[model samples]
Target: MFAGDQNGLQGDPRLKAISEAIRVVPHFPKPGIMFQDITTLLLDHKAFKDAVDIFVDRYRDMDISVVAGVEARGFMFGPSIALAIGAKFVPLRKPRKLPGEVISEAYVLEYGTDCLEMHVGAVQPGERALVIDDLVATGGTLCAAIRLLERVGAQVVECACVVGLREVKGQHRLNGKPLYILVEPRQLTNCSAPSVTIITRRDQLSYYSQDSEN
Candidate 1:
């Protein structure tokens, strides 16, 4: 389950395989909630590496100075990608998680509302930044992430995620910032099903969020 020392993988086939490796838990965190679980994908070494490689390859030479990952889930691949690109890893965490003086931005979620925090000086002015998350449902978290970075004068290059559930509210939420997704399983009403759309851009990823971001 570990793609320990190999990378440089490209194309949809590898991404599709990585998407397939992600497990979906029905009614998780709440009834009628189909929680997309990346822990399963994390177990697959090659899949995890491929995911990180995809982001690393794209940003390695983009002069991206900072890689900011959303709390919890985003922590999984953020550091690795930052390391590959020779950038610093910044964690945007939940309230009070950071011990230093921090700034916060509030956002709504598919389920509720929450805030994201970052250290006061994690990013400097004119620094190119990239935001990473495991999945984007309503995009509230990503939106807040972008705002947090911009407030500090960072140029948010793009927001990347493993999956995106299409939600109309997500549009204009980033104000033209590109949101890239590795995959969006359009159909697979459950984890047991076998259909997913491998997406590389927001236009395609929006196809999955018609009903709800979940």
Candidate 2:
């Protein structure tokens, strides 16, 4: 997602596609659980490029020297974004994920807790950075990442996400340093009806239709 004060930026089509690509699955990994899935968006070239373009346009003029993405899914769009902005990509990995000399920090997740590690010498002092992810819940992971960056003397310029739960207090954890998301969870209610469906390539358009119909 692209960060901005207003939603009517130059990338509305991209935002719409991203909003449509997101699927909500209930009871994932356990009962009483709902998961926000972005795989659909990632798999679609137009949508993925749209997402990348939005971020690129948002930070094109900003002096961002590095783009640090959290582990796993963050790697999907992070490096592309870094390349788009002419910035180096940095990874904040799970414990023991990185090989060589590393730095680590522990953080709480909405479900439990985990730790992140980075190569100690990766980020230089006074570097400018942006953090991106597909989704944010409690903001714990992002905060931990920001702390890690600060510890290494890098200045975090902003935080961006594709989907955000506005009802939650996640943004507060960032200390109001310009949090941005293409779609807020609150907006889900605005759809005629919202449903999650697993669609094959042949049924992709139908899936989007159902999303709007629901």
Candidate 3:
């Protein structure tokens, strides 16, 4: 699972552990779908710590002022990363979810229209920021988050995710900005960006099959 996280250049046991925590279920929330259930990993302490540590270590050099996590799931690890880096945690939420005067950006999801909001002036001008999400399939959520953060004058240093699903076709929205992930679908089955490869097994041979085949 560290295949993508290592930029396809390295591997690690922690990555393998993180991958096993993610479950794959066929036809979830709808038909013809495979959802990466992160709850398995999220529930485990060591797995969650490893996942967060990867990001924390990756962005350690950057002078990150805030770590923004989107919604419910993002909230899980975002705050931990922020705490590790000694930065403030910002929450990106749906419309009206926040009580303050928030700036909002809307984007399309595979299922329906979605929106993300941040309080006005949550980030100061020229502030270095990093956005994290559990996963990125279409890049819609990440793009919307970048827009909302940039709207207030934050420099998006990078974007990261535990998994990326390279089938939805949305990486272009990042505009060449740095994107990091732990794993991608074993096969390039489709032209999807922000692809996420979830691993439910611990066997090294199966998880690294893609690298071996190449």
Give the alpha-carbon lDDT of every model.
0.73, 0.71, 0.71
Clash total of candidate 3: 11
Tell me the tens digit of each residue's lDDT in model 3 across 1-214.
3555345436577877887777666434433334667888888899888888888887777899989998867788889899989788999988898997888898765446778899887888899999988776557678888988988989998888787755444466776677788865432345232232322211111121222221
What TM value does model 1 have? 0.81
* Candidate 2 lDDT score relative to the true structure: 0.71
Tell me the spans in candidate 2 whose CA falls farther than 4 Å from its real position.
1-5, 8-11, 186-214
Best by lDDT: 1
Ranking by lDDT: 1, 3, 2
Candidate 2 lDDT, tens digit per residue, 72-100? 77788899989988999999988888999
Write model 1 residue lDDT over 1-214, tens digit each, in one string: 1121222333456777787788765534434334567889999999999888888877898999899988788899899999999999999998989997999998764335678899998899999999998876556668899999999999999988877655333535786888777765334553542233222222212223234433
For model 1, the local distance difference test gives 0.73
As for candidate 2, its clashing pairs are 193-214, 194-214
